[model samples]
Each structure stands twice: as C-alpha cells, then as structure tokens.
Target: MYDFEYVKPGSLDAAKSAIAGAEDGKLMAGGMTLIPTLKQRLASPSDVVDLGGLGDLAGIRKDGNSIVIGAMTRHAEVAASADVKAAIPALADLAEGIGDPQVRNRGTIGGSIANNDPAADYPAALVALGATVRTTKRELAAEDFFTGMFETALEDDEIITEVVFPTAEKAAYAKFPNPASRYAIVGVFVAKGGDGVKVAVTGAGPAVFRVAEMETALSGNFSADALQGISVSADDLNSDIHAGADYRAHLVGVMAQRAVKAAG
Candidate 1:
C-alpha cells in the first residue's frame, strides 16, 4: 500500500473536518475494499480518515415504523439483532448471508452502501424496503440514493450517518451468489407495503434498480406465476467470468420469484 496519513476522528464533526482538510482524503470504514484497493495501488489517498473510533456511529434503533441503523454498525450486529430478526427477519437474513464470518465481523453497513458494489446485498434490501439513506447533509430516498455503479448522490466529505428501512407488510431477499466470492450473481428483494409492491434487483445490472415491470405484475398477483412472461433483457447488465449478462438476467427473474415465494 502507498504511504498515507491516518486520522482517527473522535466524532462526526471531527471526521468530516479531517476529510475536508486533506486534498485527497478518504474515509476508511472496515477497510474491507479500501485497503485492498490501496494495496493494489489503484487508489492513493493522501489521508485515510478512520471512522472506527467514532463510538457514536454504531447502533440499531426502532423509530416509529422504521428500523434505523447507525452507519458504522457491523454486519454481524445486524444479523444478530433480536429486534431486527423479530421485526424484519428478511433484512436480518440478508445481513447473515453477506460474505463470510470474517467479512461479517469487519464490514460496516455504511461502508458496504458507500462502496456500492453492483453485486452487494445491502442495496437490494434498501431499495425494495423503501429505505432512506441519511448522510451528514440530507436524507435521500433509496431510489434516489443509488446513482450508478460505485457512484452515489453523496458529496466528497458527506458521510452516511444512518439508514432507515421502513417496516413492510412482507419482504424477503433471494440471491444466486458466486460460490467463491459469495457476491450475488443476481439478487432480488421483494416487498409488499401500504404503498403497494416493490421489487429491486442487484448483481444483474450496473447498479441496484427497481424492476417496475415485475413490481406491477406482482402487485396484482403476488405469486411465482406473476413473473411468468416478465423478463430481464441482457442489454444493460454486468457480464463477468462467473456469469454472463443474459444468464444474470434470467437469474434475476428466478430470484425474484424465490423472494416472493419465500416472503409469503
């Protein structure tokens, strides 16, 4: 890894200030992906602002109809939360299935969402659950939060403080994960709320996106049969060695059906 200064900020303001001060500073959360990039010499930030020391940015709270998760809360915590499991079991299941034991232990929710890997599980949960992403600046609806691959609406120094996922009537997440990496080849989150039905797909596209076609059909008939003729075209999907775009597209349909079935 390239030489860089490390700053362990004590508070939110301190972390923001440290990040804003450096010319090419970057916030370090869990270091699951950032450290690997640094070691590969892909990114060389002048300063690394470590958010781990900020004790305030970690917890799970019930806020009215939503469950609010602090930015720095680790995956394992979310997976193990009694409140989360009881109220939103599908979310807890998503967290429980992320990566492996080590990644679950070290990876933070904020870090995962910020990185926004196309195959990551959190984005699917956020989108379908109609969650709100809270940053140092403002709250962004989950649909508006994800801009594109590895990109978000966040400004340079704005850190994600928390995420608010509304309690849906029913919801579940299904994934066809890569055996080796455990990253979703195609993952879908299905939810039925007062607003109606919503379906979000990740791992198949450049970013997590709502499958409007599927959503409409499912809203009328919440069943595997609802997704019969619905198809995900391969024209704008991610194609890696593990799976091709067409295959991923096909998997999206399959996963969505599974999510609906599992949710019921």
Candidate 2:
C-alpha cells in the first residue's frame, strides 16, 4: 500500500474536516474494500480518515417499526444482533452468508453499501426491504442510493450515518455463491410489507435491480408457485467466467423461487 496520512477522528465533524482538508481523502469504515484496493495500488488517497473511533456510527437499535443500524456496524454484529434477528431474520441470514468469518468480523455495512460492489449482499436486502440510507448530508431511499456498479449517490465527502430498514411481514434471501470468493453469483431477496411485495436481485447484473414481474406475481400469491412462468431476460446481466448472463438470468429466477419459499 502507498504511504498515506492516517487520521482516526473521534467525532463526525472532525472526520469531515480531516477529509475536506486533504488533497485526496477516503473514509475508512472497516477497510474491507479500501485496504485491498490500496494494497493492489488501485487507489492512492492522500489521507485515510478512519471512522472506527466514532462510536456513534457503530450500533444497532430498534426505532418504532424499523431497525436502525449504524453504518459502521460489522457484518458479524448484524448476524448476531438479537434485534436484527427478531425484526428481520432474513437480513441476519444474509449477513451470516457473506464472505467468511474474518471478513464478517471486520466488514461493515456502511463499507459494503458505500462500495456498492455489484455482487454485494446488502443492496438486495436494502432494496427489497425498502430501507433508507441516512448520510451525513441527507437521507436517500435504497433505490436512489445505489446508482450503478461500484457507485452511489453519496458525494465524495459524504458519510453514511445509518440505515433504517422497516420490518417486513415476510422476507427471505437466497443466493448462489461463487465457490472461491463466496460473492453472490445470483442472489435474490423477496419481501412483502407495507410497501407491498418487492423482489430485488443482485450479482446477476451490473447493479441491484427489482423484478417487477415477479413482484407482481408474488403480490397475488406469495409462494414459490407464484414465480412460475416468470423469467428474467439475459440481455442486461453480467457475463464472465463465473457465470454467463444467460446462466445468471436463469439463476435469478431460481433464487427468487427459493427466496419466496423461504419467506413463506
């Protein structure tokens, strides 16, 4: 990794100031993505503002009908949180399925969503559960927050404070993971709540996306049979050595079926 000035700020304001003052600054939540990029010389930030000491950005709480999770909350914490398990077992399950023990111990939800990795798991849950992302600057709906692959609506200096996920009446996640990396080859999250049925897919396309057809079908009958005859076109999905667009598209439906059955 390139030599860089490191600052562990105690407060959000201090972190903001430190980042703003640097020529090229990057926020370090769990260092899951940033550290690897630095080691590979993929990113060369002049300053690394570590948010670890900012205690305010690392907790889980119940807020009315929603579960609010601080951005810095680790995957292991999410997987183990009683509140998370009670409110959204599917979410906890998804967290538990991410990477491995080491990655789960260190990777943060804020880091995961902020990185916006196309194959990341959180985006599917966020979109399916209709969660809201609270940033230092503003709040963005999950749909609006994830703009594209490895991209978000956040400004360069903006920091995610927390994520608010409304409890779903029924929800579940299913994924076909790549054997080596365990990143999702095709993951689907299905939810039925106040917002109605939502089917969000990840790891199959360039970005997490909703399947309107499946959502519509499941809205009438929330079952694996509901997904019958439904199909996802391969036209816009990812195609690589891991899986072809056609296979990924096919897996989308398969995972969605599994998710629906699990949700039931």
Mind giving the per-residue lDDT tens digits that candidate 2 earns over 38-135?
99999999999999999899999999999999999999999999999999999999999999999999999999999999999999999999999999
List the candidate 2 regions with Cα displacement exceeding 4 Å.
none
Each candidate's lDDT (Cα)?
Answer: 0.93, 0.96
TM-score of 2: 0.99
* Candidate 1 residue spans exceeding 4 A from truth: none
Score residue 163 of candidate 1 by CA lDDT: 96
Candidate 2: RMSD to truth: 0.7
lDDT, candidate 1, 26-117, per-residue tens: 99988998999999999999999999998788999999988999999999999999989987899999999999989999899999999999
lDDT of 1 at 182: 93
Query: For model 2, how many clashes?
Result: 0
What is the Cα-based TM-score of model 1?
A: 0.99
Q: Residue 91 in candidate 2 has what lDDT?
A: 99
